[model samples]
Target chain A: MRIAVIQFPGTNCEHETLVAVRDAGMDGEIFRWNRPEQELSEFDGYIVPGGFSYQDRLRAGVIASKEPVMATLKEEAAEGKPVIGICNGFQILVESGMLPGSGEIDLALAQNVMVKGGRIVRRGYYCGWTTLRHESLPRRSCGSFLLDGGALLQMPIAHAEGNLVTAKEGLIQELADEDQVIFRYCNSSGTAVDEFPVNVNGSTENIAGICNPEGNVLGMMPHPERAIFSWQLPPPGRRPPGPGPGRMVFESMRRFIEVSR
Target chain B: MRINLRIWLKIPDAEAATVKNTLVRRMGFEGVIDDVRRERLYSIEADVGNPWRLVKHIVRELVNENKEECLVSIDELDLDDGYVPVKVGLHIEDGEAISAKNRLVRRLGLSAVKRVERSNIWKLYIRSDEREAVAEEIARKLLINPNKDSYEILRARARAVGMRQ
Candidate 1:
């Protein structure tokens, strides 16, 4: 399938995302979403890469969502084309209104385990670019993939505002009711955490990603692009990162496009 | 992961309101409901990241040197009300924290305490008025000679408690 990766000024991970897509052996090109008349029809799907768009000044992805590219993508996504928003990309999708509106998710401010311990630990992680050793990340990330339910994925995260928030009601049921939630944050043992560390980002029901009403658009905080290699899987001494179910998310989308032809 | 004491204070006053506002702005919390009540009551209420450091900073601001004589006047009021301005203890979850935390507890002659991971927070707890003494102790340890910085921290801490409001 022909895929286009949106390239914005602060989007640093577009190239890596492109690498993952290309390595998967699909026709993929990096497109600077700002260029005029950037036709969405030129590609079958679009991938929004992650990074500190507009410096995350007024909340993550708040600015980039207003971009011309998002405006176009949102329209096309509504018509049934696939769009994937990752990290900052996910934030952009939410801001752009491509995904279901969060209205107001009560956020809980907390710190990364790394910050508390004064160094990075292999066990616990949250957003940003870092080498992830996962046998289970794929599973965590994909467990909620496009499923439209609030859940948690043991996915790696690296953002300062990675905390999850909900407004009005319990965000889990709301998202699940719409089938808008796509991923959740769970512990390594495939269960959710209790209180303190549940869904590291504090996402309700451990949700890590969510989808639009149509389920054609997915926004997630984890980096599935980082998991393109098998060697990166967790070590043998560790129970092994387990099967990366999230990979199938991309693979399935690619297949979905292929079957349409 | 490793700590001696920690705490998470839900400040209730204007002093805390100012600091809370500053923090919200600094943290870049956008679309927040602007107001001391809404701003102070941030939507993203989560566990305290570093309870000890958090309290220590608050103590520093509370004890910071400032001309806002009300804090000292409060002491006089305490005396007039028949209460000695002795120090109070602030239970901490982590012992090894910013000097401000240790300084406040030690300086005020307040006992330092700890809790196991099962507790998930600081082991010590201090009464209302004693917050000043513990905060002053933290400032002294930092060698902020004038005690101005210490009082600022204390004011900031008490503000959250609604005491300095």
Candidate 2:
């Protein structure tokens, strides 16, 4: 499968995403988003990694969302081609009005409240590595909001504005109805439990990932590329391999390509 | 590679996490590994693009918007003999409302106030230096004509935290 990773002005993770795609047993290519008019249809799918594209001007992903390439991205997303965006890329996706939650994300932009009901306002919340486990349904949080909702997967979340915010109907709920939420921020057991530190970013309903209406487009904040191997484990303790959510996403995309072939 | 800015804040854990998350998620760095327990160490891998420029832009945004999170480096903070917990707060007012004027800090009886850009919020670069002296300087300078309720709250907090001047 030919995969195109979008490289914008401020994107910092394009190479990592590139490595991720190549590691997934697929042909990974870096494509410049500035060259939006280029024939991107040749690639099987596109991955928009994270970064302050255009310095996150006028709000995160706002400028990049209006860039020349996004016009083509919107068209492709409409066509049901698989597209994945991580972190700021997800912000761009939402800012461009591609995600379900209106256009802007009402994210909680403070420190992580481990055990939400705390007296002292803590400082660092997005640090440390949590064991990723698949959720029955994907949920949004301050960590990852790029994965599809309603799917269970374990992926490392890293972000502050990752708090999933939606339009009037509660975008997360609407995505849940379509089984589009593909990731969740849950306890080690994969149960839909909410507590301090467990949910990490105070995402609504512990939502960590979500998908487009067609389920073909996946966007989440967690870096699945960072967790491809067991050696990457920062003392996984006794957790098993079922919750390696990154592979699930990669596998799913690979399968989509395989089936297409 | 990432630059380190050492500032003091109310909370450590949550603020560190939030900043790191912003670095990795919104800013889209490979990752940010903590250095030690010093609340400043961050790691970001090289990207296809120039990350230094990106980091500079992201850091400026964070410092301007996230006043409660960012600070000037440990080295810079050490220069202030008073050991003030200095968190550089840059307050944005209208167009070119503020500029980096070190002499003004001295003239207003203030040690130093790092000012940059016409951002929305006051980017207070608070460092863990001489808290008392810096707070006093702030009181004398910026707090001279204060916002009633807000200043009252700040005064109370500063007094409670043993702010000197």
- Best lDDT among the predictions, by candidate number: 2
Tens digits of lDDT, candidate 2, A209-232 = 666655666667677776665445
The candidate 2 chain B region of ten consecutive residues with least summed lDDT is: B144-153
lDDT of 2 by residue, B1-165 (tens): 223343334445443343334333443332222211112212222232333444444345434344345443221112222122323222212112222232223344322234322212112233434445544544333321111101111211221111111
TM-score versus the correct structure, for each prediction: 0.53, 0.55
List model 1 lDDT by residue over B73-118, tens digit each. Answer: 1111211111112222222121123333444445644333221121
lDDT (Cα, tens digit) per residue for candidate 1, span A1-261: 788898876788888788777765677988886676357767888889888776664346755655667768867776677788887887777656565543222222222332213332222234442221222222222222232222222234566544444433555576666656555555555555533344454444555667665566777777777665544444424445434434555675676566545
Which residue window of length 10 is worst by lDDT in model 1 chain A? A131-140
Q: In terms of docking quality, how is candidate 2 classified?
A: incorrect
Clashes of each: 89, 67
